[model samples]
Target: MPLHKVVYLANNTKLYLWKITEDLEELYNEVKLKDSSISRLDGMKSESHKKGFLAVRKLLQHIDYNDFDLYYDVHGKPNLKPQACGIKEMHISISHSHGFSAIALSDKNIGIDIEILKEKILKIAPKFMNLSHLDNLTEEEKIKKATVIWGIKESIFKIKNETGISFPNHIFEEDFNFEDKKAFAKLKFNNKLEDFKVQFDSFEDYMFVCAFQN
Candidate 1:
């Protein structure tokens, strides 16, 4: 599998997904990485993680961008070179899980996260989300809903990229139906309150969430 999907979103946002079918060597040969990226790749301990990193570069190349056009802030957030993105205010957020890697590009503030649905999220649901939201749902529904809430919080945190933001204490998801495929969350951090619009979808056993500041 190559490019899995491209989601065009509101506010000039586009989310790209890549299914990682290539092995580490195949991926490594497919993309050109900068010196720093090369060093980082060399330091990775997992083959799957290395494949994910290279797959992201492959996604960039699919969009006519490359590793040279990508950089990271001191905070370790990925950024596109202004000249390469061809937009003054372009923003990007990236994530990977298991066999998938994803990136979201927007002219507005953005964050994205991809999660492999698992029963583990259910056991830890109380630690991050409101248990009331989990009521009235079957066991399967509980797992799906819990995964979405976790993704929502993760995405919001990625967008904010600030310190001391606790998922349980700082983020709250509004009530929503599983069929709605969208939700809202509030982040109360640093003595400031902020809202985010969340959109998500399930692909295979994986779920991805994208957040935009509202």
Candidate 2:
């Protein structure tokens, strides 16, 4: 399918998920791209990567914006250019896994991430989060929750867009149950403190998280 799902995350925030069912040619022919986007697409070495890039543009068009309106900063963060007349700025974040690509947009600054459930995250749990947070859960639940926590930290990093923000030392997620599907986190870096409201859900064996700056 094309646009697999649309999630209304908050009053001004929304998420879009695209399941990669179309082939390279099909997706490429579906959307209009700027010259820069076309060059970027041509330089991609893999069809999967090309599909993800094109699929993101599809999602942008779904919301009445196109690739021309999107740009990346020196920090490699994706941003949107204002339309003819606008006073508000829209924050956007993008993520892609093996079989899916997603984008989230909101009037408020936000970040998002999606990850395929895998055991490798279990191996690196200590590198990015508190191991104690995974206590009292089956091995399966542990993997799921750990993946969620990883996504939370990644989303938080995307929102902050600052250099030298170590995931293990700078971002901290509060304890919460997998059943709750939502949590909060704190980012302490450069002698400044900030908070975020995190929400996540599982789909097709992948977990996606959205973080709203607080």
Instruction: Please tell me which predicted candidate would have the highest TM-score against the true structure.
Output: 1
lDDT of 2: 0.91
Residue 13 CA displacement from its true place in model 1, Å: 0.9
TM-score of each: 0.97, 0.95
Per-residue lDDT tens digits for candidate 2, residues 124-162, read: 998889999998899989999999999999999999899
Which residue pairs show collisions in model 2?
A: none
List, in order, the clash count of every candidate structure: 0, 0
Cα displacement (Å) at residue 84, model 2: 6.5
Candidate 1 backbone collisions, by pair: none
Worst 10 residues of 2 by lDDT: 82-91
